[model samples]
Target: MMLVFALMLCVPAFACLAMAMERHQETLFGALLSAAASRVLRCAGWSALFVALWLAVAGKGWALGLVWYSGCTSLGAGIVYGLLIVFAKRMSAR
Candidate 1:
């Protein structure tokens, strides 16, 4: 959860700030969507990791295919995409 929140909020928040320094703007809706999507994706990716860990602890996580399978899980890109919208507004305002 912390990881997800950090990524969904802090990462972008700081990035936004840095971008703001250069002049960037984004809509509230965009931020919301970005946060939401990022949360979802982070959940999925972690879920995959959790599963993998569980399997490993059970002595099953390490499989011929499961190694690469972990990569199959995706942290949704929607977050950055949505964030981009909000960011776009910020930039335009300048």
Candidate 2:
């Protein structure tokens, strides 16, 4: 259950991180984001990732929590990357 929570947080964190970049902003939003918006998203993404790590560490012991954190981050990043590819392909097809 705790691991699941961490994973959930990680997914959006990665999404925010992706959207913060110019390339991903174009791919996802169809236009460039303002510099301020990008900065905000970048900060929010890092903050969420830290919160997820804290949740994992607090819920489980350090050793187990760290292991689960690693897995969650990897899975979350992969999911976001896959979604980005799908969206890019769909946009190209249109």
Candidate 3:
């Protein structure tokens, strides 16, 4: 269950980070995302945050849920950023 939550939390973080970076935008999504990328990423990030909040509230309580949501989002964003950096480096090398 925790694993499922963790993976769910990662989706938006990864999407936002990937779309925010030009290297990732070109490498992963290609030209299809050239226009409206920022808009899409913004929506995705907000949606993810909402989902995290919902999950936390459902899984725990109000106070604990908010805390959980914050921690999870932060951790997930950090992980996605790190992965993006690694991927960009590898792609640039090749």
Candidate 4:
């Protein structure tokens, strides 16, 4: 269950993190991520979502899987935001 949650969280976490990159500030909702970063995040998000689906198939039940996905994705978004802030500060200091 914990693993499932962690994997599910990877989706939005990467997506949001990519968007939070300094280079994206001028875009709408920071959607203008770099091509490489965008591709990587898109792949990661889809992979994580697929893994969650597999977990459901592996007897975790649809409800539990959905709940874990929701909770983890939300939590991951916040985590990514915090990480971006820390990294941005470090970069600026350099």
Candidate 5:
């Protein structure tokens, strides 16, 4: 259950982090975001990731929680990367 929650939080956290980038902004949102918006997304992304780490550590012991966080972060990043590629390809096709 805790792992699942951590995974859920991680996916969006990674998404936020990716979308914070100017390169990803156009691919994901079809336009580049303003500097202020990018800053906010970046901050939110880091904060959410921290919260997810806290949730994991609090729910499980330190060693197990760190392990779970590592897996979640990797999986979440992979998922975001896949989606970005798909979206970029789809936009280019049209």
Candidate 6:
């Protein structure tokens, strides 16, 4: 579904965007913003995937149509985003 694609791309895109902007500033705000953005993206992707799974389990195509995205509080998302941030940090060292 469209939701799946959107969130999948959004997560990486946000991280990439934040990583790209790292050079614009080195202040605390910039770092915090990038971190937050990465986290958001990660969580968004996780929510998308998780909801998609739930939909698949429902076994009803009609039921699957309901758009369910986590507003937040996804442990998986936090973990994924944290890894992304770490990877981004390592890559940007160049």
Clashes of each: 10, 0, 0, 0, 0, 0
lDDT by residue (tens digit), candidate 3, 1-94: 6435844776675668567666667876554465577667867877766777787877777887777777787777788777777877787798
Model 2 TM-score relative to the real fold: 0.95
As a TM-score, model 4 comes out at: 0.56
Candidate RMSDs in order = 10.7, 0.9, 3.0, 5.2, 1.1, 8.5
What's the residue-level lDDT of 44 in candidate 5? 87
Off by over 4 Å in 5: none
Kindly list the per-residue Cα lDDT of model 2 for residues 11-89, writing each as its tens digit: 9999999999999988888899999999999999999899889889988889999988998899999999999999999
Model 6 scores what on Cα lDDT?
0.47
lDDT of 5 by residue, 5-72 (tens): 88898889889889899889877777999999999998888988898898888888799999989998
Best-performing candidate as measured by lDDT = 2
Prediction 3 TM-score vs. true: 0.70
Q: After superposition, how far is residue 28 of candidate 1 from its true place, in Å?
A: 22
Global lDDT scores for all candidate models: 0.42, 0.92, 0.70, 0.60, 0.88, 0.47
Worst 10 residues of 1 by lDDT: 68-77
Residue 1 deviation, candidate 4, in Å?
4.9
Give per-residue CA lDDT, model 4, range 64-84, as digits (tens): 767765666666666766776
Error of 4 at 86 (Å): 0.7
RMSD of 6: 8.5
Q: For candidate 4, give the lDDT.
A: 0.60
Q: Give stretches of model 1 more than 4 Å off.
A: 1-33, 60-94
When sorted by TM-score, best at the front, the candidate numbers are: 2, 5, 3, 4, 6, 1
- For residue 75, model 1's alpha carbon misses the true position, in angstroms, by 17
Pairs with backbone N, CA or C atoms under 3 Å apart (clashes), candidate 3: none
Clash-forming residue pairs, model 2: none
